[model samples]
Target: MATIFTPGPALQSNSSEQNRFMEKLMAKILSFYDEQSLIDVTFKVSNPTAVVPAHRLILAAASPYFENLFRGEQGNNPVIEINDIDSDTLERLITFCYTGEAPITVNNVGAMLKAAIVLQLNDAINSCVDCIMKNINGYTLQAAYTLERETQCERLKQKLIEYEIKNFMEISRGVEFLSFDVEKLQRILESDNLNIPREEDAYDAIKRWFNYDVPARQEPLPHLIACLRLTQFDADFLLTHIQPLPGCELLAFKAISWIREPAARTKISMRFTEPRATCEETFLVICRSEMNYKLLQYNKAEDKWQEYASLEIDYTNYWPILKDENILFIGGYKNGVSCNIVRSLNIRNKTWQNLPAMNQARRGHRVVELDGKIYAIGGLEGNKVLSSVERYTPSDGWEFVSSLTVGRFDASAEILNGKLYVLGGRNINGALKLVECYNPDSNTWTSCADMTECRVSLHVRVHKGHIYVLEKYSANQSSQSVERYDPERNTWSKICCLNAEWARIENVFSFDNKLWSFGHPKHDDISSVSVYDEDNDRWVKKCSLPNVDRYTYNIVPVALLSSK
Candidate 1:
């Protein structure tokens, strides 16, 4: 009994050794499958002359669909009738079962993916999905989108949608775009992400699709036309391009009504009043004094400036947001008293309309637009820093939502990835480096990684999936530094500094794929615009703006006004 085998320490399995064993085993099984040796099952495909013979044990080990089917078989060898899978797909799947690989191309990837999904072959399914996504292009987008929809692959479907939206200008010119069904075309036209320069281009695309086969496409023309922001078009386009369309008479008339009479927009559908993702934006400045508030628009193309509109009301430090063809001015001060008066300007007609008032009166507050609603964040009311927040919906009036974790004024806010981020500000204690994030879906606020330096009166802008914060420059610092926040890593990194000449930065915004800082230098009478040179990681002076006193200049957020 003492001579019985004594166990020693267990040996660790090496990955290389395991891989070699699997390779040899797979080679042997592949040979067996290729030679039709030890074949125990036959697949009868839809084609009369096509039949596949495979080893039962290998197929049973590969997929659970086959394992369950074989387990229920009443005989040693069975003939399976497959009406859904073709002969070529069946052979490829069987080869993958033995060799762990399949020759998947764009031509056959859709069919192979469908067959693999039906057979519950997870490895083959993933391989086919990868192949389909790899070869997706403007020419193949319709087919890929249809396949993803049919297979219920939600993630793949989203990728297809993004591809179509980003490449709509090219895809709409291709033959496959004409072949898309009405539902698919309608969905594409309804998206705000379409890379179109103007609403006229969208109408042109729809007309082209309709003219391809007028008789068959006429019925869906109106539906497709409704998807466009018809009101955004000018009168000349409405008469020459839209009115002449086969089935767009009603749409043309309604659009003209909204354009001529701004009040009609209240009755019009919000879909037609919304702006596309590519709306043209420009810098808007408001210089305020005792009773004078001047509104100016910057012309970047010509490096010129012009007066935009004259304001009748006197409000200081009010927040202005551009929504489609309108500009909304939220919570500010009137005669040194905090007020909740909200004003909306329809720039097309130069008309101002009164919106619902905020619940709390505050000045130096931050306002942002998300999901077609407006949010007014933390600010100072009287001598107390308030943490109250309010949201204004078009369908509903202003209502209070979740308050900030900390009450501070002069803070900067930006929307990134569907969430609102409020950065550094000043409170009773002093300047703050605290960062907080607000999620509208959960109606809650949570803290984020703090800035490297405590700051106030900073400006934040989101560009290309990153948030860039412009810290105000003072005499102590050589230049105003810019820090970028990476949401994926939840960290902040200093990218570069602004021109040392800029003694202070009043606002930071993105336009034409560049970050522009608006401010003036020390002892300078006129403000200036400096654009970030990303290639060199430094700010370059673009041009000087019209003279405005830095003490009286109200830094309005950049406005993305409708070009129409």
Candidate 2:
């Protein structure tokens, strides 16, 4: 037995009672909906087998679509044709007009929304948009995007972006993602809101779309590739995945130059370095030793360093350079010998390849990239210091550049303000505070203001247009202090002193505007790492390296890549 909460049925007062009375009234009115005794309008749906009969008053009172039709009618009975929407969708929409509610699923949300839009039923269209949002997923996201795109549904489009951004990586891995229209894909890529942790994922998505059917999709590659941050993708990724493609020739060359010159990033319209561009920023650490080199990637989510590979050569005293997913070991010592074997390791493929060796066998030298060319300067050769500078151009091999005034070894070098500046290193003078600036065009080294302190064992980097040097305090390196040089004034000032613990910091990288140092320092023996809170001017211990081995590891040469 069903409870009749409507009491006497004389127009209920409570909300629930009103709903019940309305439903019952709708059912009763719908019972006589097609009866000829009251029938005045007939609708012929586009589906051949469908025809619906309705009373003029019931429809005219509920919908302007039928109201306008009835007002313009000239005969006793008029047959109206609704060819825009098929019968099933129209039938449900007609019921919704009377009942003030409609039931819909993901499969029919598009059709129902379409009919409601054509009928000028704003309420029903809102209901359809809500329904679409509730059911949107990887399977239906693209369809909803396409449908709403055509319908111009702004509310639904916003819901689509929120739902789809989190699943971008998953969507790219799907076959449907590869099948999206080039324009549609580009629209999605244009968003700064995309949650692609790695710029590589964005690049990979485009590669998949182009290669899905190369012969047919080749034409759109140019337009689509324009959306990626190609310059940010380093050299190996562009070479392996994009550079080899004949269609990517010009784009690849421009991207390579872009990597070398980040300031002139006008060629590409987008960059992946923004705060919201990714979920987690990924970085790498190059663990170098006299015997071998190990590549480790630190995963923030996992809070651990996973080794990428162990190379076959002794990269000790090596000058490393990164081009995308690979690192170049340019003229480093192998087995205590100054070897000029220039090799590169593809971090993605874990494969090594050799490039043309330098004109002179060099180790403990400074290598820096400027204007798309490599310059190696100042290093020791079997206890003897050499200043023979050489320039390397891709495909052009190495050419002799003007040598440094004083022979330097173990010198730290970084390019800044369009000039290569080599900082503190051991010259014949020993642990000198010498600072010199090298001009590529002029091929000359100009002496600059020396540092406040000297360093034989030092960690040097250029950050925010300033050169920072960490100098050791003692033989055990238990105490240390840092000084930064302002290029504008060519002056060095002491910043802060670090607990001798940082003496072992082989490599350092800054993320989220915080400094991260990698390596175990001194008697701490346990591999220790720390993060420098710039605001406090102090180092906060972050974590310790895995204690899998008794051998203390030396980590250096850090690079920032996409987390994915």
Candidate 3:
């Protein structure tokens, strides 16, 4: 009884110590369970007498600070348990939380994003997104885009937009020669608040970010002025005193207004250069309701213009070709004809002839001349989109070639450095911005850099080792937009747009060392002859085509004499 007098204080101290010990024990147990679950393993003593401490295991698992940091309210709920996630994923997630060193390939990024969202770990979520984006390719981009759309996570969406913009911006810079995916770009542009920044604004932004010296007061020089500034002057007159800059060309005073006329309707034809014995640069255009074609000739009697001749042939949904000095027109609706026929126009003899018919009648087909052979590319063969391609040699006639990865129509084809470059076209379902290059040596097509815009029925020409594409904005509409591609750099640059009335068709060619385009004018009263001077970088007007008018025009440039 006497010893018990002081027992109250002692008992109180013991009780406090026990409480603390129990608290520590619970924490250890929790950590141990967490660790065991994360790694999908169990720890047991080798001997029955040896007891493993639960607290130590728990502590190891809970040591990752990020787990607790991102736990938020979820951590406060004592009954809440972590879901079954892969051991590696859990470990990586924990590591990211602790040290902020994001795992390069954290599979199930969407799930991680969801977890980050729930945990309110903004940094972790952003890091995961960046990792996903860095690894995304064409195959993954669509999935990523879909995921972003489904999640509706504001941060994720922002990140995606940022990624797309940055990627395209970088692409735009390096794309001196590019084929754009118009639909993809349009989607991006539509989804984001992207605007066409003024040149000054772009320059300013570049200067600010790069900290490079930029001309403070860059002046807008006229095409003539710019031409005079170049150092090399050999064949300067080839550009007609117009400096053919990458993005800018000379503008003809009269041609400008003609292109600007709103009432120009959907078809107008113009003739460039009066037919002369010295420089017989003449064009005849006919714009029908459906399509148009041009007849162009280069007369060298004056030794001014090279002797070249061309005729534009129009067909309903297929690319027109010139074979045996005759226009082989494919893919168009002939009222009673069930199959598409190859309508030929003899340029040399000035007559029309029908040749061996296509096995599968198609529209919007691409015909390319490679190695003295003509290959008919993807288009609508009857009502079906076709990936099948066929080749025509003087000896073989029409024979099937390998099919493309995708079916395409309304596409443009050009030969560069002995390879076939097919740029911006559409499929049967929609418009396309895909760029494919076919190598005859390899007998295969490989994807290449894309363009900044999506356009069909664009005017494409190769000049001075560059590809120039003049694209209209819409079907049955006129556009002033132009783009140029440099195969050497594999990049595309925006060139000065043509006047609005200057429609796009297969009427573009390099004549007299200059770019000449003939198409259906947008304005009824305006002419269609568009001449681009590479030297002066300007456009000029010649006489309008006297005959043959149509909506869609085709031109075939024939060399009367070998320039070589």
Candidate 4:
């Protein structure tokens, strides 16, 4: 009895009483929703009716339409009617206005969104957009696209475009792609980010879409055919495929003009060439020393590493196999001077050819390939770390493209979603955690998220549309952690920490649909290869380096054969 009287209010003893009070208050508020309490409003639209028992003051305060009506001279009105919105959707919208939560589903989202828009409910609008996002796909896109257009939903429209562009090739094969009209077909083919590896694939896909209902779709042929990159087709494919198609006369003339006078052809709407299918995915390891360049590729048939191709030169450098017949070796310290000699070797003919030298000579640079073009990003040009960038094409030789936003040597680069991504590497300022993305379509470089830790000489590879980066040089921690970047989410997460420390990771590439990092294991002099098994989420050792003789092979150079 003394303990109870000791405090003004026994806070601990009444904690349960507070919960009981809230529960009773919520129940009382919920009872107001019943018609028995007092029905005040009715909403009708689209053949549905909602009879809601609610206080006019609460409803007016939550919704703009109600506010506009009640703020007038007749604020005391008891009954109100709302139109242009169905009863079930109005119920959800009204409930959301009261509880600050909207109930929405794919089936009723369109109706709910219309009600929310009429009532000026932003939260409900966002909720509906999210509902569509979770459920929107090939089958539902048409309906979703109509709803977005009707309501002027910017976010949903962008997402629809992105989904179409991101999965263009795959979407073309879907049943819904079979249902696409000419305008929808143009939307997909016109996107610069379309993942069409070959132009002919897009042509064939459009033809299939056109032939679905020939009489109805044939009229749009000229409009649709104008978008194809007909110039990318060889004479045979163009003559046989494009010429034979009806209503392709204008497109054929444009194609011929593009070939004869490509620079001066103004009427022809030539498409930016999509990446060609250059080669099958393969792994190549390049070992460098004072005057030796030995390349080894994973021989899948023998299930082991074998000698691929080699070029003896006077430098340390970066070289990756073109994944088919050719391999490239670029700028490095040649006889103690930064040199920019770009060399290539044909595996089939065993011949070597030297392309045009880079705009500048640089050592310790990262060389990457995208869409069959090679780019030489930042490296040490003379005594200064250079941010200058250059591109090489077989037709044009070497042309300087955009420079890197940050100047760093020995950075890691990879191509994902048709963009060049450069990750951590050392500059004169030291190791960088900066991540930047270069869009080939725009020729612009923009910064992305930094790494979990500052790193230099890291290894990055794209596997199944995700970029995986491994810490090759970091003093902060030796946990041997790896970071994975999802381009879709624009975020990075620390993934598997390897069992063995990644020391002097000479090369890392995707092989057999799995990420493999090669170098000497922790505290071991001999180099080995380990595969990251997604099923087990651990690094599984596969085999040793092709060269067990450590005496000659010191610096290992690597390349991923992503294009043919």
Q: Write the per-residue lDDT of candidate 2 for residues 1-564, one digit (tens) a residue.
A: 977663564554566877987789877787776355566667888775588776778777777876777777542556777788999998888878767788788778888888887887877888998887777763276788689778877667666656556567677877677767776687777676676655666777877788788998888887777667665554645665676775777777777676666677775544443434543455555654445556667666767778766667544566677654457888877667887778887654677898899888887887877755788887877788998899887768999988887789877787676688888789777787888898887878899998876776567766645778875334445466778989889899988566636535656665644677766666676667788875677778865765333222322223224224
Query: In candidate 3, what are the lDDT values of residues 1-564, reduced to their tens digit?
Result: 445445467667798786887789766644654564443322232222222212222323434433463356644332334443334445445545444555545356766666566545567777767877777773276667667667667776666656655453343343220222333333443322322121122222222322222232123223212212121121222243323322234333223333345366234333332221222223323343334444444343532222233444433444556443355666565442324577766554666776677777776677877655778777665567777788876556688766777677777788766688888788756777777788777778888778787768666766656778776443435346677888778888887656545544446665554566665565545446667765676667654544344433433333212343
lDDT of 1 by residue, 113-221 (tens): 8999989898998887778777776327668767876998655656666677766767787787777789878878888777664565687688788888999988888
Cα lDDT computed for each candidate against the true fold:
0.77, 0.71, 0.52, 0.69
**Model 1 Cα RMSD, 1 decimal:** 24.4
User: What value does the lDDT take at residue 526 in candidate 2?
Assistant: 67
TM-score for candidate 1, residues paired by index: 0.51
- The C-alpha RMSD of each candidate to the native structure, in angstroms, is 24.4, 14.0, 24.2, 23.9
List the lowest-lDDT window of 10 residues for candidate 4. 550-559
- Model 1 scores a C-alpha lDDT of 0.77
Error of 3 at 146 (Å): 74
lDDT of 3: 0.52
Candidate number of the best lDDT: 1
By summed lDDT, the worst window of 10 consecutive residues in model 1 runs over 551-560
The regions of model 1 sitting more than 4 angstroms off are 1-278, 534-540, 550-564
